[model samples]
Target: MKSMKYFLLVLLTLMGAHYVEARPVTLVTLGNSLTAGDGDDGIGGGYPTRLVSKLQTANPGSVLLQFGISGDTTTDLINKQLTPAVAALNAAPSANRKIALVWIGSNDFFGFYNYTITEAWCSGMGLEACENSEFGASADNASTILAALQATGAALYIALLDDQSKRPVITEPALRAATFPNISDEYAARMATHLSAYNSRVQAHADTYGAQTVDFFNTTIFEAPATLSDDGNHPSGAGYDAITDIWHNAVTGSSPSSSSIVPNSH
Candidate 1:
């Protein structure tokens, strides 16, 4: 009788351990079109979908709550998205592990070169001056976003934006002329400088707010034609596939694998 009781206790302990190991996760994704699946219109719905699928293998029944709007700037996220994101985090199961992923500032950077620089607020300034002022405002808003998300008690992961000016849409002359008739080589160069500066601000905020910074700045994935969509601005299906790998590697602290990772949909 004593031996049988000991065996039962050990079996119960092992079952409890298995349950904890497979505890569900609550993942919140926050950003703009890139997070919203702009370029790839396939059923996968971009990185968030693919990421959740990968996460489920380790943590069964993981849930994703995405808050992404196309053309949104840092200011837009602060003004509109934060409240609901917090609500979702709060509503998640008490036992679930919480995480938030933020990838923004692309629109903020693009708007500065395309429109903000020409606005009356920046009327008399040179390219560099206007760029600084515009990106400065964006950086401040981004910091606000990070702070709020950090306060939610979720593990935060923020992605650094690449220099949009170097994208093929702007680098290829014919495409540039078609997209922005008035844009010049000088404008593109100035944009790159300001974008790099803005990325530093983003990195500093991530550090201060206790978020991990996912390095998207140095990847040549965006520069490769095969990774770009027909519009040349967004990532193609293949590009998103590569993006999924990069993000998974960061989250799992594992090397990126080219082999199949997505689970069967059916």
Candidate 2:
């Protein structure tokens, strides 16, 4: 009877261990308006919320903790969001898998084009030099955010920023005239080049730290009218849905480039 009782205790212990190991994961997203679901016309908070639902379907009981502030730049993320995110990840159950997703830098570009130029923040520095300095800062800030998240032992996914220069706010003449009459063709061209370099730096950071990159470069969501919000900047409900699929695919080891996931309204 003593031996049988001991055997039963061991069996229950193993079952408990198995249950702990199989607990659903925790997802923490850190970013700007895009991650905050600014233009989402739907009740779903944003891609993070949509993603949590998808995650729960596969691994029920999954949780989402999002830190997305509108108009936040890479620097703002480091200053405001990173600490809270790290704390949350550290507080998560050790047995549950933890993941952090970072998507930012749109406002960095916007600030450069809109405020920097208008205010002449780099008046004497020359446009090329000013761009290099600004973009370099953005890259470094992003690297810092990624590195800190990695330290929490959570799987990290960093988003490659879309080229903001191509968004409807810039490409559409009417929108440009209404919103940013000061942004000339030359400035727009320079922005495209700098944004590309910034994305390359982000990719390098992900590679160095073994974090996966969620590609936002080749998507039509920004260019497509249907996918863009009424503001012509942030993603709409359908666009957020599309973004959710991309992140989901990246997490699941599937090709995120599937046409069904990234829709082209063109």
> What lDDT score belongs to each candidate, Candidate 1 first?
0.77, 0.81
Q: Could you give the C-alpha RMSD of every candidate to the true structure, in order shown?
A: 6.6, 8.2
Compared with the true structure, what per-residue lDDT tens digits does model 1 show for residues 1-266?
98885675576467542112345678898889888888885655878998888788777888999997888998888777888998898888987778888888988766666677677767778766777777888887767887887777787788888878878888888877777655578778887887788889888988898878888889876788888887778888888888888887766554555312221101
User: lDDT winner among the candidates?
Assistant: 2
Candidate 1 similarity to native, TM-score: 0.85
- lDDT tens string, model 2, 69-186? 9989898999899999999999998666788899999889888887787656697888778889888989888779878988888888889988888998899878887887778888
216 Cα displacement, candidate 1 (Å)? 1.0
Error of 2 at 103 (Å): 0.2
**lDDT (0-100) at residue 185 of candidate 2?**
82
